[model samples]
Target: MRIYEKVHLVVATPGRILDLIEKGVAKVNNCRVVCLDEADKLLGHDFKGMLDRLISNLPERRQILLYSATFPLTVEYFMKRHMKTPYEVNLMDELTLKGITQYYAFVQERQKVHCLNTLFTKLQINQSIIFCNSTQRVELLAKKITELGYSCYYIHAKMAQTHRNRVFHDFRAGLCRNLVCSDLFTRGIDIQAVNMAETYLHRIGRSGRFGHLGIAINLITYDDRFLLHRIEGELGTEIKPIPKVRIPNLCIRCRNNSIMSWTRWSLKASCIPDKRSLQLRLLI
Candidate 1:
């Protein structure tokens, strides 16, 4: 029992950590180096009570290391309260990568899959991950892509841990070339040969890792512009919009000219000095 005190311990989950602490399986009183990985997630309000309980039991003079890819306000507060005059290291600005070419396209939600398919055919991306915002969408999109004669696998938080492990193993072994997932794979999953990535909003961070030459294609809609703007502000980098090439309209459904007619008439009357014509147009 005395020799066990010198061994390093690891507890993966907050609940498990608290349970160990309560059961006297782990002792925090003598801990000299405490590392909180994914500190932003660990410092969420959902884990606040557990963290407080853990901190209350730790030695006051111990060093606390908080590591996170994205720091939230709650995590910052936790550092201030717990850490003693720690120096901040921000490497994001210095971490430059020349290999990745990031591009964004303003696409409608309905056209996302079609646009992805077009990109796959044009670019011939051998390995990629398509990130979606939700688990249901991940499954739906994976099914759709697989049905289209592409091999795709999906992972999400809703899946059992064993299933997720199997999917990740298959992905790493190159048994599956395309992976469709939610934010679950954004941080820790390491697939070194990913040639391209497609995602919406905040999940774009999954690509271009370790200075590898990668292409990140963001399929954004007008509704996601605000989110994109916020992410740009956080990263201190603007994602330039891709210039859309005009495509010939072939669909009968797109032939409705009511909206265009209204716009053209409104603009013409607005430029004209005929107040009566404008009034008539407004009345109509």
Candidate 2:
């Protein structure tokens, strides 16, 4: 709407939007139209109360449009409660990504970085985002990738808002070729021509945005197959498992040379003295 030079476009987070309405940044009484993008996420437990408050304050006569990529039962309830004779647009049946290639590689957690490095070298992807489930892993992967001579940066929800903005800005400007991030980058953030996306099950939601030509390469493990299956079931699509390739061993620089025995789990190789420790690490 702002791009079309529409009158009075106020975009904000659900909580802040409510605050603004109360403080007069926007007038709910005067609002002729209300649009909620990613309505399912916005209507989740975290923002449900805020949504309720906002809806309670909204004027009786107003058009509300709720848009979501994925709609579960909660979103449906919210719509039935707030919308009068709402038009149901079920795009899930028609939704398709023609330009994106989805491939899964069964590799271990430790070898994910190595597999990613191999893929990056093989594809020579100009720009990419590596999504991790946690901030600590993002930081560790970014550091390792940088040490391996790749220009990489990482951002997570725990970081200051200003820092996240700067990191995103730099990434968009092509100052960095690779980004390691949590689910924060999976939804709203848009970067053009992302040639590649390397992620796990949780982060698979980030790729193939807006019909762009992209490749989503997931490094999965035997343990991750169940989660991947659940995602495929939810999406009503087949996530093809790619043939796993053995990662060549690299010399360790650790001072303690306690003979490290190697094991392969997804496509990653780890040198561990015991399997119990590896299982514990994976659980963590």
Which 10 consecutive residues of model 1 have the lowest summed lDDT? 275-284
Model 1 regions more than 4 Å off: 1-35, 44-63, 72-74, 87-98, 196-206, 209-211, 246-284
Q: Per-residue lDDT for 280 in model 1?
A: 7
Identify the candidate with maximal lDDT.
2
Q: lDDT per residue, candidate 2, 1-284, as tens digits?
A: 24334357777899987887688655567777888887877887779688878978878888899887666667778888888889987764323333344667778878887887776554435577777778999899889989999899899999999999999999889798888888787564457545331123224443344433355666777897787777666556676654455445523222243333332223233333222121100111
Clashing residue pairs for model 1: none
170-234: candidate 1 lDDT, tens digit per residue:
88787987888877876644575563311122244433444333456678888877877775665
lDDT of each: 0.62, 0.63
Local error of candidate 1 at 70, Å? 3.9
The TM-scores of all predictions, comma-separated, are 0.62, 0.58
TM-score of 1: 0.62
Q: Mind sharing the TM-score for model 2? A: 0.58
